[model samples]
Target chain A: MLTTLKQHIEQLVPLTDAEFAQIASFFTEKKFKKHQFLIQEGEAAPYEFFVVKGLVKAYHTDTDGKTHILQFGQEQWWITDYQAFYSGATATLAIDCIEDTHVLCITRANRELLCANQRKMEQFYLKKSSFGYMALQRRILSLLTTNAKERYEQLLLQYPGLINRVPKTLIAAYLGLSRETLSRLS
Target chain B: MLTTLKQHIEQLVPLTDAEFAQIASFFTEKKFKKHQFLIQEGEAAPYEFFVVKGLVKAYHTDTDGKTHILQFGQEQWWITDYQAFYSGATATLAIDCIEDTHVLCITRANRELLCANQRKMEQFYLKKSSFGYMALQRRILSLLTTNAKERYEQLLLQYPGLINRVPKTLIAAYLGLSRETLSRLS
Candidate 1:
């Protein structure tokens, strides 16, 4: 688990062993069964999870009784209700496992504490935030200009080779299309 | 000028007088005429600008010779090429003033310096970042689900009374629709 975190951090910015340790200090190893909720709506997001093993999805139901898949987290990916985790608000998103999973969980308080006490940790957080910002920017652009076929292709690119790992219906929801439309395209 | 910054900060987290002064200390005021590029693509983005007066648009031109307007900043709003600013990469986005403008600028180095030296400043950064995160998330969802008309309406709702302040072509680009389509809808 620690090895996984180290690898992920290195991809963003290289850190010494001591610096990596300071970041690892905030994370605790956690296990979840398939179909378990790591987080649920209306509760503060206690921790953001880094997947060590297994698949997970983050989603929320809209007012019209529809479920929208916001993100899917596989190995080396992180997932969280960022608003709830950062602002002490109730989550609008819920996280659930697709398979039995191992994760590294870091709570809001611990994450902030690490940022305060360690310069390298602050740098890591900065990098992570910036990358997230960029992804959001790209996703917004895609949402504006791309068609369903283009979106599906992009999603496949983002999660490469994982299309068969999950249901088509969920993928349809994530693409903001009807299941019939996805079937036709598929 | 300071009053606008104060009001903007207050909308996030209310600052005491001293706290406001500390926040203000990081900013340097500057003026620009219409069509001035605040920062251009392929140049490193060194600072974030807060608009005290006038209008500016941030955009990126893709390989197809099409522009994507990421956002626009007017009074009480902030703008930057966040990816380039945080990562020190050459900017993928560019900014230009639509009219005469005054801005308060803070470089990447000074932002880090301010956060390191002041707890209040760190909190302020955190609050602003969280808001940015939420806005990005909403943009992602909007991209997935909204039609052109619906998306335009949402943008109108977000900017409120600022729609008339900028050009229709840019607004159409921001909405991910052709100008003719936007014109037809309008």
Candidate 2:
């Protein structure tokens, strides 16, 4: 799992062995069973997770008890209630395991210290955050312009294997389509 | 205008006068009339702007000829086709002036050089990127869970003065609400 973390960071910015050791010391690994809650909505998020194996989703439950899928995390993906984690606010999203999972976790303080001490880690994080921003920018455009069918199609094209990895109903929720409409589109 | 830039940067991370001069040297000031294009959709975006005065908006026009506003930029705000600017892709959005505007522009290369040379600027950019990501995360949730009226209300709450600064029709488009529906709600 730690090897995966090293590779993920290296994929963004190559690091020296000594530097990798320094970054590795800041993270702790944890495992969760399928359906386990990693963090709950409306609560403070203490840490961010980097997935090494299995699947997890960040989502929201509305006042009417409808679930809205925000993001999914798989191997090499990072997931967290970023607003809560960064701003010290309560989370507006919850994350739970879609399958038994392993993740490397880092607290806000440790992540900051790592960045301050390791310029390479700061560059890696900066790149990740910028990429994440671009992705969300595209997602907002899709939501604003595309219909449910087009959105479903675009999602398929972007994440070809996601249809197989995620349950159909959850995908429907992610696309903001009713289950019947999603079934028809699928 | 440069004073505003200094204050904006200093708000996030304080710097010496020498540091501010290094940061400011990379930017060039430009002025645009209302209705001028910053960068058109489907073209390369060469620069990102920091608004000094007046107003601007980033928008997407769908194939069906409907316009959807992506973001608004006012005093001290950063505006650009971020996906294109960051990735060297053709813009998926166009940014144009809503009123006569003055802005400080920076090319991608200069931005990279600035971050490479200045640790404080890198820190500033990282903080800005993370904040932008969190804002987008909340936006995605709003799109998924809220109705148009609720979205409009939330927008009003978030940007209290925006309603008065922007034209009503543009606000309607931004909220993905029909002009008639927005009129009724507003």
Candidate 3:
């Protein structure tokens, strides 16, 4: 599991074994069963998690009780309520397991410590955050520009395995399409 | 103008006078007239810009010549075709001056060199990128969940100075609302 974290880091920056060991020291491993909640709205979200196995989702529930899917965390993905984690504010989003899950967790302090001590880790995060930012920008473009069929196709292309794994209703929410519209597109 | 960049950086990290000088040396200042293009679709966009004066808009135009506003960068904001800037791909978006604009531009190489030589710059960027990621996440949520009027209100709240400056047609495009619809709400 630690190897997964190490490999994820090494994808952007090669690390010496000692450096990897130091980087590994900041993280703790945790597991959850399918359908378990990892974060809850209005609670503190103190850590960012890197998935080692299984699936989880982050979402926001509206005052009207509608749930909107924000993202899915599968193997090798990172998930967190970033606003709350960084601001030390209550979570506005909740994360729940879609399948029994394992993740490596790091607090903002430990993560910053890793960055301060291991420049490679800081570089890794900068790259990750930049890529994540670009992905969301593309998502915004899609939301503004694309039709339901185009969005469905883009989602499938971006996450080839997601359609088979994520519930159809959730996929509809992510695309901002009605279930009937999504059914027609798919 | 470089002082603006220094002030923006200092908002996140304190810098020695010499450190600020070294950081400032990596950037070149550029000026654009209103309606001038900074980045054009299908062309190399090799610089990330920090706006010191005036406003710019980044957008994508579809096959049928419909424009969708991706962002408005005013004073103290950064704007670029990030996809192309990082990946060395031709830009898929275009950015243009909304008013006569003055900006500080940094190429990725110089940006990385600065980060390598100045750890604080890396810290500044990590914080900035994380904030950008969270802002985009909130945008995706608004696009998914909010009605036109709610989105309009949220946009006003987020960028309090925007409504008076940006053209109504562009604001409507940014909100994915028809001009007639936006007129009704406003």
- Tell me, by TM-score, which candidate is best: 3
How far out, in Å, is residue A111 in model 2?
0.3
Question: Among these predicted structures, which one has the highest DockQ?
Answer: 3
Candidate 1: where are CA atoms >4 Å away? A6-26, A42-44, A63-66, A117-120, A147-153, A177-186, B2-27, B62-64, B113-120, B147-150, B178-186
**Interface RMSD, model 3, angstroms:** 0.5
TM-score of each: 0.80, 0.98, 0.99
RMSD of each: 3.7, 1.1, 0.7
Residues A59-177, model 3: lDDT tens digits: 99999999999998899999999999999999999999989999999998898888888888889999999999999999999999998999999999998898999889989988888
Cα TM-score of candidate 2? 0.98
Q: Count of backbone clashes for each model? A: 0, 0, 0
Error of 3 at B71 (Å): 0.4
Q: Can you write out model 1's per-residue Cα lDDT over A101-173, one digit (the tens) per residue? A: 8999988888878877876666666656667777788777676556789888998998986798889988998
Tens-digit lDDT track of model 1 for B76-140: 77789987987899998899998899999999899888877765666666657667877888777
TM-score of chain A of 1: 0.95
Q: What is the model-wide C-alpha lDDT for candidate 1?
A: 0.84
**Candidate 1 TM-score over all chains jointly:** 0.80
Which residue pairs show backbone clashes in model 2?
Answer: none
